[model samples]
Target: MSRTRIVVVGDVLLDRDVEGTVDRVTPDAPAPVLDVTGVHASPGGAGLAALLAAGDGADVTLVAPIANDPDGRLLTEQVEVAAQVVPLGHAGRTRTKMRVRSGGHTLVRLDDGGPGTPTTVPGDVVAELVDAADVVLVSDYGGGVTRDAELRARLTPVAGRVVWDPHPRGAPPVPGVRLATPNVAEARAALEAHGRHADGCGGPAGPERVAARLRSAWGCAALAVTAGAAGAYLADGGQVRFAPTPGRADGDPCGAGDRFAVSAALALARGAGAAEAVEQAVVDATGWVRAGGTAALHHRPGPGTPRPPGRAGESLEALAARLRARGGRLVATGGCFDLLHAGHVAMLQTARTLGGSLVVLLNSDASVRALKGPDRPVQHAADRARVLRALGCVDEVVVFDGPDPAAALARLRPDVWVKGGDYDTSALPERFVVEGHGGSVVLLPYVPGQSTTAILARSATGPRPDLEVLR
Candidate 1:
C-alpha cells in the first residue's frame, strides 16, 4: 500500500506552552507571579496540520514561509520530525504564540512576530507539489500566505483537489475547491463580508443556512461550518447536512480545527463522499479533544518506561502511530476467547514473538452470541478483554462489535495477522485485508484437546475435573 500524498500550504508559526502555578502576587503590583514549571514548544498553524497528517501515516510535504530566526529554527525542528519542509521566502520575524497555563487552564496568551508572510513565492515548485498531491490542504491561519498572488495562481488550477480551512483574516478559498471548512464565527463574518447580515438566527436551521450561504458565496463545491463541541454543518450539492460529534467531549480544543481539516482531507483522499468526510472529521476532532488535544502530543513514554496496559477510551490510532514511529512490526490476532485457556495463551504468546507488539481483537459479547449459541461466552466482553490485557504478551485489547474482525483489521493495519492453525490461511477472510496492506498472514499451531467448549462441558459435571487439562 503506497502512502497517501498530502500537501499542506499555509502559514507556519511557533507555539510555546508555559505551564506553571500562579500562587503569589507581586507586592509592588496586583499582578500574579507564576512559578514556572516547564515550557513545551511545537509547530503551530499549517505546520501542525502537516505534522498531524504525517502522524496518520500520510506522506506529507509542508509548503510554507519560514523565517530565519531562533523561533523559526525551533518550529522547523519540530515540523521536520514528521514532514518534509519546502521553505518559501519569508519576511519579518517568526510568528510565535505563547500561552501561560496553570492547572490545565490558560491564564494568558502573548502573540509576537508580526506578519511572517512569504516575500517570494516559488510558483513552479508550488505547482509541481499541487500536481503530485492526492490532497492539498490549505490551512490558512490569517497569515499572509493565502494572499500571495503566485501561490494562489498555482492552487487555482487544482481547486478540485483542495480542502481549504479558511481563517477570518485570510483570503477566500479558490473558486471550485472541493471543500471549505470554517468555524461558525468565521462563517458569520464571511457572510457579513459578502453583504449578508451575520446576526440573524434562523432557528434550529441557523447553521445549515450559514453553511449554505458560505458555500454559495465562496463558490466552493462544499462548505462545512464547525461549531466546536456541537459538531459541524455541511452544505454540499445543493443540500444541507449536519454531522454531530460522536459524543460530548470535555477537554481543551486547542488543535481541534487542524484535526478536523486534516482528517477531512485524508478522507477525501481515500475516496469518501463529502458528507462521509465531514462526519469522520467531526468524530476525529471530537476524539482528539477528548484525548487532551495538543497536550497529548508530549506524553510519549520514555526509555525503560513500560507501556501502560490498554484500557477502554484509549486511542488505538495514537498507539499504532507511536509503535510505527519506532519502525517496529505490529502483530494482531482475533478470537472469541470465551474461556482464557492454554490454547488461547499459547497462540497469543507465539503471535507476540512475530512482532514488536501484539493487539488482540476480542469479539464483543453480542458478536460471540451470534457466532456461538445464546448460552455461549460465560464471560462478558469487558471481563474477557481484561483477562486478555493481563497477559504479558498482549500489548492492547480491542473489542469489536462485528461478527468478524475485518473492520478491526482495517483500522489497525497490522504487519502480521495471526490465527490458529485449525483454519486454513487461504480460507480466512482476513487474509485478503492483511495482504492488501502489504502484510502477511501466519497460522500458529492450535493447542490440541484444549477448547473452551470442552472446558465448559467438564465444569458443568462436577468439581473433580483435572486441573492439568487447563495447562
Candidate 2:
C-alpha cells in the first residue's frame, strides 16, 4: 500500500536525557552526587510528531524553525531520518530541554534556549506542501511557527484532513480543522481562553460538554480530550465516544500528545472516521508509552552492568524492576525452542510488535528433556539463548528450570503473555497468574506443518530434506 503523506507544521526542539547514578550526598552541599553513565538525544515538539508519523509508515514532511546553532544541527540530523525537513529562519537559539535522571527517576529538568519570532515561509511554498498532503498536522508547542496569520490562512482552505494539537502560548487553529486533540488540562484552559465557561466540563458530563464547547469554539469537526490513564474522550457530530486505553504504561508523557495527534491524522488519511481515528490513536499512544515513552531517548540498563540499555539476560527481579520504573510493556513467551524453526521466528516477531520488549523464556536443558522426552533438544540451553538473542525480534532470553513459566511470570509480572495459536487461553495454566497482575494472554497464529516432531520424523526417514518444506 502507498504510504499516507502527512505534512506537519509547528515548533521543533531538541530533547536530551542525561542518565546517571546517585550515591552519597555531597559534602559541600545537601544535594546527592551524580555519576553520569550515558546521554541520549532525540527530536522533540513537532519534530517528534513528524518522526512518529513516519515511524507509523507515513511519508511525513516537517516544516518548522531551527536556529543556526549546534542544537539546530543535531535536531536536523535526527529528524531527517524519518521526515523531509523544511527549516525556517529564526534569530534565537533552538529550543532545548535537558533532563537529569538517576536510577530511572528524573532529578531535575533544565530548559535552555527560548522561542523566537519565526520568519514566515513563502505562502506558495507552504500552500504547495499542504495541497499535496493527505493529512496536515499543526503541532503548536507555544512556538511562533504557527503564529503567522498568513501561514494559517494558507492552510485554511486545504482539501486534506487537518489535525490541530494546540498549545496555550501559540495561536489557535483556523476554522474547518477535522480534529483537535488536547489533554484534560489543555482542554480546560483552551475553553476558558475562548471565553467559554465549561462549568460541567470536569464532571460526568465533562467529555460531552468540553467537546461541544471546543468543537464549536475552534470550528473543528471533532475534539478528543486525552485523560491520561482514563483514555481519551472523543466527541464528533454531537455523539460522544470514550476510547479507553488498552492499558497504562507509566513514563514521561512528554511526546504522548504528539504521538496521539500523528496517529489520528494518519488514520484519517487512511479513511477512518474521527471516532475510529481517535481510538486507533489511543492504542498507538499506549504502545508508545509501553515502549519506554520518552525514556527510549535515554540509555537503559542491560544485563551484566549496573546500567545497560536494551534487552540482555538478567534476573527476573532486575528486569521487572527496571521495566516497571520506565513504565515499559513487557511481552513474554516461553517454549523449548529446541530447533528454532521458521514458526518460532514468526511467533517471536509478532509478539514483539504487540508491546515494547519481547522476552523469550527458554526452557532449561532438564526441563526440555522432561517435556520433549530423552531424544529431543538438539541444542543446549546456552546455544538456544545465543540463537534467540541473534534475532532482532527477541529482546531478552531467560532460561527457566520448569515445565511451566509460572515462577518466572510471578517475578516478571509481564503486561502480556504470548503463546502459539494451538493453545487456548482456557487451557493455559498461567492464565490466572498473568491476569492477576493486570496482564493479558495473547495467542498468535501457528504455522501448519512446521513442528519439530514432524521435522525429526522426516529427517529420520529420508536422507535429505527440502529447505522449502522447513520454511
Candidate 3:
C-alpha cells in the first residue's frame, strides 16, 4: 500500500522541558530549590504536527521558517528524525518554550527567543510539495508563516485537501479548506475577531454554534471545535454533529491538539468524510492523552517494559492493585452482557476511558434470570466473560451472582463507578457503596434505541439467519 504523504505548514518552535524534584527551601528566599534530574528538548508547533503524522507511519514533510540559531538547529534535528524539513528561511531568532516540572507537575514555563517570521518562500518548491501531498495540515502557532502572502498563495489552490489547525494571532484559513480545528476558546475568539459576539455561543449547543459560525466565516468546507475531554463538535455545511469523548483520562494534554489535527488529516486522506474524520480524531486524541500525552513520547515502554494486566489469566484483584499502585484509577461497570451488540460495545468502550483500566462486573446466569427474567442470559456466564474479555477496551471480566452488582462492587472498590444514563444514580444500590469508599459514580449517555431485551424480542419474532439462537 502507498503511504499517505502529509505536509505540515506553519511556524516551528523548540520545546525544552526540565524535569526535577523539589525538597528543601532556600535560605535566602522562601522559594523551594529544584534538584534537576533531566532535560528534554523537542519540536513544537507545526513541527509537532509533522512528527505526529510521521509517527502514524505517514510520509511527512514540514514546511516552516527555520533560523540558524542553536535552538533552531536543535528543533530541526529532532523534527528531521521523524519528518523531512523544507526550510522557508527565518527572519528572526528561533522561538523556544521551556517548562520546569517536578513530580509529574509543571512548576513553571519559560518562553524565549523570537517572533520567528519567514523571510523567504520559494514558491516553486512549496507548490511542488503541496501538489505532491495527500493532505496538507496548517498548524498555526500565532507566528508569521501562516500570514505570509507567498505561503497563503501556495496553500489556497490546494485548500480542498488542507486541514487548518488555527491560532488566534495567525491568518484565518484560506477559502474552501477541508477542515479547521480550533479549541473552544480559540473558536470563540475567532468569532469575536469577526465583529461577532461570542456570548451567543453558549449552553449545550455552544460548540455546534461555534463550529457553524467559524466554518462560514473562515470559508472552510467544515470546522471542528474541539472541547478537550468533552470531545469535538463538527460543522459540515448544513449538518452538525457532536462526537463526545469515551471517558475522562488523567494525563498531560500539552500536544493533544497537534495529535488531533494529525489524526483528522490522516483520516481525511484515507477518504473518510469530514464528520467521520472528526469522530476518529476525537478517539485518537483521547488515547493520546490517556497515554500521558506528549511527555509519554520521551518515555515510551520498551520491549522489556512490564505492562498492566490486559492479557489473559490476570486476576481482577491483582489488576486493580497494580493500577492503584501506579496511581491509575480503576473504573468498574456492571451489566448482563447477554447479546453483546453494538450498544454494549459502545458502553464498555466508554467505561474503559474513565480510568487506567476497566473491570467489567458481569452478571451471573442466575443473576440475569432474577433481574431480566427466566428467558434472559441467552449466553452462559462463561461465554459472556469470554466475549467481554475479548474486547480490547475491557481489562478484566468478573462474574458475580446477584440481581445487582452491589456486593461485587464492594470488593472491587473501583475509583469510578460507571452506569448507563438510562438508570437513575440516586436509586442505584451500588451508589452508596461506591461513594462511601470515596469512589465517584458517572452516568454515560446510552446509544439510542438499542437494548438486549428488544433484540431478543426481535429474535423471537423473526430472527435474522445471520444470528445464532442462544437458547
For all candidates, what are the clash counts? 0, 4, 0
lDDT of 3 by residue, 1-471 (tens): 999999999889888889887888999998879999999877889988887787777999999999998888888887877779998888778888898987667789998877888998999999999999999999999878889999999999999999999999998888999999999999999988987766653443377887888888888899999999888999998988999875554456888898889899999999999988998888778666655565555553342221211111234444465346445689999888898888888988998887888888989999999998878779999788767766778766678887788887887789999998578888999999999999999998878878898888886799666565663
Top candidate (TM-score) = 3
Residue pairs in steric clash, candidate 1?
A: none
Q: What are the lDDT figures for the candidates, one per model?
A: 0.84, 0.79, 0.83
Tens-digit lDDT string for candidate 2 (1-471)? 788999999888788888888879889999988899888887889888877777667888998888888889988887886689888776589888888988777899998786645775777888899999999999998878668876788888972378999888887778878898888878888888999877863553475578777878988888898888668988787777899865444545667788789889989989999988998888767655545566664433432112112112235765565655544688899999898888988989999988877788899999989998998688999788868866877666778998899888988889999998677688788888999999999999878878888778888887444566776
Which residue runs does candidate 1 get wrong by more than 4 Å? 199-205, 301-471
Model 2: residues with Cα > 4 Å off, grouped in runs? 201-205, 298-321, 324-471
Candidate 3 backbone clash number: 0
Clashing pairs in 2: 300-308, 300-309, 301-308, 302-308
TM-scores, all models, native as reference: 0.67, 0.67, 0.69
Worst lDDT 10-window in candidate 1: 303-312
Which is better, 1 or 2, measured by lDDT?
1
